[model samples]
Target: MNQVTRYSPLDDLFRGFFVKPMDFPSGMPAQQIKVDVKEQPDAYLVHAELPGAKKEDIHVEIEGNQVSIRSEVKQERDVKEGERLLRSERYFGQVSRAFQLPYELDEGQSSASFKDGVLELKLAKKLAQPASKRLDIA
Candidate 1:
């Protein structure tokens, strides 16, 4: 069998910092990444780890078989006395992730929840009646 390698642009994304080490497999102020996908007979569950993200910052949308997850955050510190600016390496921008759902999911029956820096989404796959058919052998 031939080797197959699927590519995703966000696969190597870092939350806090974008730049990766040139020599070592390391990055500064590392970003959090925890994704779990579970499929049942009638539904699908998706869980994503998003730390330091607010409800207003997250935006979810589903179109056809594609589900898009996008979030944006901006942090600024005002100049203050006795406090000098130091080297900063944390991220202050937007990040997004998209996935292609396997089955057709209902838009109304799906829901999402966030707690402890985790985002959980429940998607219900629509049920279609199976058609009767006979297999043919050659």
Candidate 2:
């Protein structure tokens, strides 16, 4: 079955006026860690977007088929001698995203890297092993 929908201009104009905004008191919108995952034959590739985050502040964890990413973005407090502060629009807080994959990940073989405000992960898939082996009589 197919359904048709109609677009209204008025709905777009007042979309968020009725609902509460996610912005903070400083007028900065809440930041979220965005991620993209790709599946290969033997591994899963992940690319996470974490702007203004230091490499040391980002953490990734894998448990079986579950994967989680976390990062902390701290607001810099540097001001030049002759510069006056006007306004700031950057977000400062922790953001995290977690998800589950189809196959279990091999934590020993998985790797991660961060560059240009982007986090890349190469998660290797765990190979299936036999549950039990026959034992010979002593």
Which candidate number would show the highest lDDT if scored against the true structure? 2
Q: Write the per-residue lDDT of candidate 1 for residues 14-132, one digit (tens) a residue.
A: 54365753454346654544678899788889998877688778888987667888877565767789987655555667767888888877888889998887889898887775988
Candidate 2 worst ten-residue window by lDDT: 20-29
Model 2 collision count: 0
Instruction: Give candidate 1's total backbone clashes.
Output: 0
Q: Write model 2 residue lDDT over 15-110, tens digit each, in one string.
A: 888796455464566899888999999999999999999999999999999999999999998899999876777789999999999999999999
lDDT of each: 0.77, 0.92
Which residue runs does candidate 1 get wrong by more than 4 Å? 1-34, 76-80, 129-138
lDDT of 1 at 81: 97
TM-score of 1: 0.64
Q: TM-score for model 2? A: 0.71
